[model samples]
Structure formats: C-alpha cells, structure tokens
Target: MAIKFKSLPRKNPQDLVAPEKFYASAVGDGEVTMDSLAEMISYQCTVTEADCYAVLISLEKNIVSELAQGRIVKLGRLGNFQIGISSDGMITPEEVNASSITKTRINFRPGKKLRLLLNDLSFKKVG
Candidate 1:
C-alpha cells in the first residue's frame, strides 16, 4: 500500500509571514494494535500468536533495559537502538559532565534489510 501524505505550508524562518513551500506530511489513518501485529506475524510463520506476543513484549522490555544502561541494542536485521543525548557544550572538556546533559532520546538506525524494504514503498497524496 502507498503511504499517504498531505500538503502542509511551512513558514520561512527569516520571513515568518510568507510560507516557503507546501511540504508533504504523512497523515496516519489509524494505529494497528499489538494484537493485530501478533496475528499478522503468526500468519506468515510457524510461530503462534501467543508466542509472537510474548516475544514482542520481552523484546520491548529488554530493549528498554539495555538503553537505560547506555548500551546499544541490535535486533539482528531489524536495526540498532541506542540512547542519544543533547547536552550543553562547555568551553573546556574538563568542565563538561553528566549534569550538562539536557535530554536523552531513543535513536534507531535502520538495518540494510529495513532500508531495502523502504526502497520498494510507494507514496500517495492525501487531503
């Protein structure tokens, strides 16, 4: 299926009044729940829905734990998940410390398989 997108006007940073151009933004139709995901996985493999659901739950928990410990978690061909931080820069390297960190966010770098899959995706315009 084609990914749907909508046209959105973005204001220029220099000139706030005039819009730079209309950009294509994704419009999500709806969310697919965990149950749906499990069912879909079960249909394509020998694994049952219950087993898939359990694996998914365990995967989520382990990923979170690893990220919390400032470790990168790689899920085989899926991708690598890591904790990225935004921090205030210091003039001297010695002055910088953990306290300088302002925010921490989860970063996902898609693996080759995922990138390949995205290359075959089609797009559709939405209202």
Candidate 2:
C-alpha cells in the first residue's frame, strides 16, 4: 500500500494573529491559562506540547528578565520596550537638582534587527 501525502493550507502572513488578541479575548471573557494557549498553538501548528512550552518559556523568561533588570534588553528589532514612570508630584527644577533621581526600574530598547523582523512580521533564520 502506498502512503498518500496531504499538503497543509497556505497561511498568509497578515492572517497571523498576535497572541495579544487571544489574551485580550480571554481577559475580556474569562481567565485563560498558559496550558490553554500552549494547547491551542500546538493544535493549530501540529506541534508537540513540549515545543509549545519551550517557545513560551523562552519568551516569558526573556520578557520578565528584561523588565526586571535596570538595563535595556532589546529583542533583536521588534520595538522598544521600556519601563515607564508615571509621576504625579510637584517637583520643581530646583528640587530635581537637589536630589539625584534614582531608577528602580528597567527599560528595554530593541535592536534594529528585532525591529525589522517585527515590522516585517516574520522571524529571520539564524545560523
């Protein structure tokens, strides 16, 4: 008996939805878990559970660590990710001079490669 092969459907780059969409939808409706997202991706991509987790884990670790530290960690050129400070106090220029403003937060600036990859909506093949 001969094995028959079936081609997968062609997916347009634009058709790729951001994970944020699902996150927003989940948040708007109810809570969703990491397992749920992993399952979803695995099902859609025909990937293994481990693969899904690996990808998610890497992303989570990088994002969290970048946000936690004071250094700007850029993800190869997607965009600039930074810690924003919202101050609602009256501090005159004189006061600014009096005390040194300390940064207890971290910011990230993505490199040009990351930005280009993101803007292109595609991941580059790394050797």
Candidate 3:
C-alpha cells in the first residue's frame, strides 16, 4: 500500500516575504491499537493472542526499566531506545550539573530493516 500525502503551503522562515512553497506532508490513515497488533502477531506465529499481549506488555515494562537505568535498550532489528536530554548552557564547565538539564526525551534510531522498508515505500498524493 502507498503512503498518502497532501501538499501543504509553508512560508520560508528566512524570507517570509517570498511566495509560499508547497511541500508534501504525510497523512496518517489510522492508528493500530495494541490489541490489533497482538492479534496480528498471533496470526503470524505459533503464540496465542493472549500470550502475544502478555509479552508485549512485559516488553514495554522492561524497556522502561532498562532506560531508567541510563542504558540503551537494543531490540535487534527494531532498533535502539535511549534517553536524550537538552540542557541550559553554562559559562563554566564546573558550574554545569543536573540542574542545567531542561528536558529529557526518548530517542529511537531505526535499524537496517526499518531503513530498508523506508527505501521501498511508495507514496500517493492526496487531496
């Protein structure tokens, strides 16, 4: 299936007076719920839907636990999940500490399999 996208007009940040340009923006079709994912996985494997769901829940909990310990969680073909932080700048190196941290975010770097999937995607322009 092709990914759907629509043209969106956006003004240049550097030259606002210039004519706006249209860019392709991906439109989401819909969301797949956890239950739907479990069912799909069950169909593809020998596991039951309940077992798949239980494993998915455990995976979620364990990923959180591992990340909380300041370690990167690597899921083979899926990729790696790590904590990233943005911080306020300090004049002196010695002055910089935990208090300088402004925000923390989870970062996901897709693995080779996902990257290959992106390369193979077909896009369709929508209204």
**What C-alpha RMSD separates each model from the true structure?**
2.0, 15.7, 2.2
How would the candidate models be sorted by TM-score, starting from the highest?
A: 1, 3, 2
Which candidate leads in TM-score? Answer: 1
Give the worst 10-residue stretch by lDDT in candidate 1: 11-20
Local accuracy by lDDT, each model: 0.91, 0.57, 0.97
Candidate 1 residue 80 Cα shift, in angstroms, is: 0.8
lDDT of 3: 0.97
Q: How close is candidate 1 to the true structure, as a TM-score?
A: 0.84
After superposing candidate 3 on the true structure, give the runs of residues whose Cα lies further than 4 Å from its correct spot.
9-22
Each model's TM-score, in the order given? 0.84, 0.42, 0.83
Candidate 2: minimum summed lDDT over ten consecutive residues — where?
20-29
Candidate 2's TM-score:
0.42
Model 1 alpha-carbon miss at residue 45, Å: 2.8
lDDT tens digits, residues 29-84, model 1?
79998889999999999999999999988989999998998899988888999999
